[model samples]
Target: MKNAFVFLATGFEEIETLGTVDLLRRGGIHVTMVSIMDTCEVIGTHNISVNADSLFKDVDFSLADALIIPGGIPGSNHLNDYVPLKELILQKEKEGVILAAICAGPMVLGGLGLLNGKKATCFPFFEPTMTGATPTGNGVEQDGNIITCKGPGFVFDFGLLIVRNLRGEETVNEVAAAVLAPGY
Candidate 1:
């Protein structure tokens, strides 16, 4: 089974974070929610609190097939400010592991220079933060091992794209159908 890790921080977008996780799980992907905060309980931007599967320091993300980041106010900033998570993200990119982000979360990747020469998209207002990437205003953009999208509205597409990349088209179709989503 494909293993994926989603990083959680305070103020993360509730829909973006949970929706992606739910879809990934439905696709039969093993997903671990890693909390960047000191505790496994994370508070979302909309005041929803979720208990993560593990703390960031307690997990070995090196074995993950993909790393996901959800975006929101200070959540993206929190993830960006955390030096260790930034380091691990860079390392994962260097290893060519799939990296996915939505909304402002892509700014974290862009800030780390991972989006250089890649086609990426983010919250429209945050395009300037995408550094060297060609900003596509699409709902989702998958450039090589990197996947980026605009916001919570595209969470399903983001999650489904991750499913498609880690599993296959057949699995994606099955999962989408099972979820009664727009089937491909």
Candidate 2:
């Protein structure tokens, strides 16, 4: 089974984080919600509290097929500022694991130079932060091992894209159809 880790920081966008988790779980992926904070309980930007599956320091991330980052104000910033997470991200990149981010979350990859020469997209205002990337402004953009999505509005598409990448187009179709998502 393919396993993925979704980082949850305090100020994360609830929909982008949880929606993607839901979609991936529906696609038969094992998704682990990881909290960057010291505690397992995380509070979103809108005051929604969620209990993460594990703390950042507790997991053996070697089993991760994909590392997902969801965007929101201080959440994205917190993700960017976490040294251990940044180190793991770089290591994952070297190992050719899939990396995905949405909205302001791509800035973390951009800041780390992972997006260099890659076509990526993020929430419009964060485009300038993607220093070495060519911002596509698309709802979703996938370049090799990296995938980026615009914002909360595209959470389903973003999640579906990750599913398509990790599984296959056939699985994407099945998941989409199961959810009654139009234009799949």
TM-score of each: 0.97, 0.98
Model 1: per-residue Cα lDDT at residue 150: 97
Task: Give the TM-score comparing model 2 with the true structure, all chains together.
Answer: 0.98
lDDT of 1: 0.92
lDDT of 2: 0.95
**Model 2 misplaced regions, further than 4 Å:** none
- Against the true structure, whose lDDT is highest? 2
What are the lDDT figures for the candidates, one per model?
0.92, 0.95
Clashing pairs in 1: none
> Clashing residue pairs, candidate 2?
none
Minimum summed lDDT over a 10-residue window in model 2 is located at 175-184
Count of clashes in candidate 2: 0
lDDT of 1 by residue, 85-112 (tens): 9999888888888999999999999999
Q: Compute the lDDT of residue 130 as modeled in candidate 2.
A: 90
User: Can you give the lDDT of residue 34 in candidate 1?
Assistant: 95
